[model samples]
Target: MAKLSLCGGRAAVTAGSRLLASGLGAVAGGERYTNNFFLYDCSSAEKKLPDHKDEDGLAMAVGSDTILAHAFSSSGSFFALTDDNKRLILFRTVPSWQCLSVRSVARRCTALVITTAEDRIFVADKSGDVYSFSVTDPQGEARLELGHLSMLLHLAVSPDDQYIITADRDEKVRVSLLAAPHNIVSFCLGHTEFVSQLLVLPWAPDLLVSSSGDQTIKLWEYVTGREVQSCDLSTSHRQDGDEDKQRFAVSRIAASCSGSHIAVLFDCVPTVHVFQFDAASRQLLPGQEISLEHGVWDVAFDASSGLWILQEDKDEVVLIYRLADGKWQRSLNEESMERLSNHLRDNWTLMEGCSDTESPFRNLYKASYDNMAHYLQKKEERILEQKQKKRKGAQQETTQQTKVLHPVTPSS
Candidate 1:
């Protein structure tokens, strides 16, 4: 669901297979939040979304139409999204953007991914269960593929379609065979906090990258459950006199189409840390820290390897950065980019009735409260009571020893 909460407003952007998708939520007329989902064809500059009324001639459910999860197939031929209304909408994007099916899911979906073969779309709902729907049959049933003990936050399939990776709020990343999802391959388990995002490296199919509320990103070899590298954001990015700053949780993780760059956004933070993946060294070298004027909502790398950032700013809802000469430079004069920015700016609202709210990511961090002082104080009190009891016993023994001592002295 992008973990986007409806406070002032919410925006999320994702790019895959030459297609860019954005979901925007805004309060309308000081009442309920109305969300709009947009799909853009980056190559032809065309845009689309579901814009039809129901068969009963009733209006669309404005509040429940918020897109929670969306993705394009690896081949860019199909696109799918799961809305808050539990409607899984699939579109064929090859010839023309056409709605193929709109099936009802059992629960609200948190994440979804389309297979490279474009056969099925695996959806993970908040119920911790995964269901696969057929891509060819419009009237197909959603088959229960797998189940997790905790709520799943993200889902991804390997390039070879052999394994499916699932991340949950229990700080677990499980790798399972796609055909038999119950047969677990391995568990990539090192996160101390809730795992937020997972990305199977496009170039290195066996390696996996995951971010967590623990303020660290880890690279894992999923088949063997080996940790290749772990980078602590709290320490690696520390600046002068910023030691006391809150350890920011990772909100999103994205990579370029070439798999040479990785971008990470922190929850409620205005900075985006870009990493250059060193294939030879198998390391994530720190690249650029793009500081924004407002808090970032989401980020994605396009098919052309352009970095797109969606922010909370009403004036500039979207920004694009391109890599030039080993540095990221802002690209501001593209016509299609301007059109997208203007469309989003027009839909953004003041989002009245919901403000001053804490981030949803705050609850993911491990709770901490120490009672060691109280425990030590009680221990000291017990020690003092024991000493007092021993003192009283000694005094009573001395009182008896007075006569006993006189008798002993007489006997001596």
Candidate 2:
């Protein structure tokens, strides 16, 4: 017997393997249901596809399994997925799962991501065609078309979903605006090969990070089209002999919500690289590194709980690491513990007067403005005072010279 947890639910029970074969489905306290199925029978357990549909059937035109890869919005009101079957799919997540499909020339869908704020979805395909869809209305419509001739490998939307960043096999990373449809926006150019992974730092929306097959990780300012930093992981093990030179490759990248740190995982190696971002120097410093037995495929941080979730490629088990105590825990279930921990940690106040303080940079900017105004005022006063003193001195000197020259007698 194997136990499987429901999607967004806490209950877990040991059920016969038959349930697993039939597909484990769970609905998280709603009229809608989330079905976890596999694209094929041979699909790995870790790669199970998730399908979200409304049980009430308010919007029934979009059928099940119509999306290739989909993700629900934060509000759970809408969901976006890519079919890449000559058309893209945008559907609602409620009981009435109304859907809209956009036709495209790209036959193979590689990656897709949705914005957090607006009702928009960015779809990228193997042919490098990136399309943006707006789902504000029940009928999803194509809002913008970003022309690209290369094969897009990965895509990541900012936390606010205001920006969409795409990495292509043509060795280019593009940043586009979700709010402004006409703007293609910025480009991050440095990788000599195909980019394998793309991640946006949640703490800093302007920061775009990417890893490439060229054995390097590059950071960019997504708005200004500037390459901020680049880390060459290829030479990470230079001291080792040439026999194992090409053994390690970066598989995934994740940044903490505070934007204070980043984690990078390697394909062959079990170790995860933690890089600390220094606000003072604006640089990433090497931090503590941890190793596991299995190759890590993905890494996610629950900011509220201060926990890090690492998914391994070889197993279905998710390793949970606590940031506060540096302890390791295992969970085969998807419970509310993560959300609960986040709520508790977020509301806990360890020190008084710490909550209202603004960031140092903000305070410094305010202080600088005040000082500049005061300096200008004082400068003007000093100039006026000096002019008055000089005039008085000159008057006194002239009178004394007149007296010495016998002009005092005439005045008397």
Candidate 3:
């Protein structure tokens, strides 16, 4: 393997007969890699979910079909996919590929989330309704609804699945207790414009992050919903004047599972900005910024693989970047890419086929509440039984040791 260090990271290239046979084993050990000079056909990468459509003659547009939002469940077995239409779709990975679940939300689902316990999927809709669906049930169940005065733009579920924090078009952020049914714990109010995104740090229950159209990202204490740190994207660019201000729109945001790093995708800039936050000082320091050709629509970090998935809007390409070396690669084949593009076009037409009075129902599924609760209860019981068995084995060993040795017992 030939290893080279460049631009704040190191890159290792595998040299082997296999590499020669494949031209480049871009896919290796579950991580994909590509250099700055190379571009691969990423059209074949599996479509995780079907296209979401709207009936109002405003079916979710194409170039905008770029996953505007995404969320990984606590178990990571499932993920929620939301497109620019803000419609929500649930995807579960089968042995071969990811498949859609029965539960789907109709409103423009801007954000998707799963409770930490993996029992429920929390969907924040543009219509201001936060819908909760039970994941365990075959029939999607709707639990409680949190109605916002304005459009519910974003949502983040805590690792414990006890709390759900939401951002709305009203520029207000609210935290509600998921377990307690309809309890509004607190509200974070400060942003002057629509709150675009919300991210909860994996390890920190108290730390919640929000990005707003006000051109800033704010970090808050989950318990209090109090703003602890704030950073202005407007200051990121050195250029002055209204042009710079107009250029800055914080589109998508993500926090590394470790809580050490944050990635912010801006609409105006072609580069993704990384920031490191100091918990002690509550300050955000600029980290490395990686530039790409197309504007970034969404960014997701796979902590297990240490890979970053960046979806670009213009070319409709999903770029995979290795965190260790900053090597960028594209997934999917040219044929698959064309298929996806065509699929999007076909989906638009299908969406257009729906009349204004008709509801859009192509990719959406709904599951029921009682079935979800029963499934979770059964799952917990099984886990507890396994734990009890392990404990019994340990006790048996201790009891045998405590038994007294009686050499003469046979004689008696």
Question: How many pairs collide in each candidate, listed in order?
Answer: 0, 4, 22
Candidate ordering by TM-score (highest first): 1, 3, 2
Cα lDDT, model 2, residue 384: 100
Q: What would the per-residue lDDT of candidate 3 be over residues 1-412, giving only the tens digit for each residue?
A: 1001111111111111000001121343354333212111112223454565667756465433334345555544555554443334454532212445534455656667777787778777768887777767635656557888777767887777777788887778889887664798998888877777788875565788888767788888867877888888776654445454443446567666564777777654567788877777866777777777654434555443232433333245334454465433444453323332343333332223112221111112122269888999999999999999999999998777777553335555
Find the number of clashing residue pairs for candidate 1.
0
Q: Best to worst by lDDT, what's the order? A: 1, 3, 2
Give the runs in model 1 whose Cα sits over 4 Å from its true position. Answer: 1-63, 236-242, 349-357, 369-374, 377-412
Using all chains and alpha carbons, the TM-scores for the candidates as numbered come to 0.74, 0.57, 0.59
Candidate closer to the true structure by TM-score (higher is better), 1 or 2: 1
lDDT for model 1, please: 0.73
Query: Candidate 2 residues 325-352, lDDT tens each?
Result: 4433344344443332232233322111
For residue 172, what is the lDDT in candidate 2?
83
Best candidate according to TM-score: 1
Poorest lDDT segment (10 consecutive residues) of candidate 3: 14-23
- What tens-digit string does per-residue lDDT give for candidate 1 at 145-246? 999988899989999999999999899999999999999999999999889999998878888999988879999999989999999888654545876656
lDDT, each prediction: 0.73, 0.54, 0.55
Runs in model 3 deviating more than 4 A are 1-70, 82-89, 98-100, 104-106, 237-244, 304-412
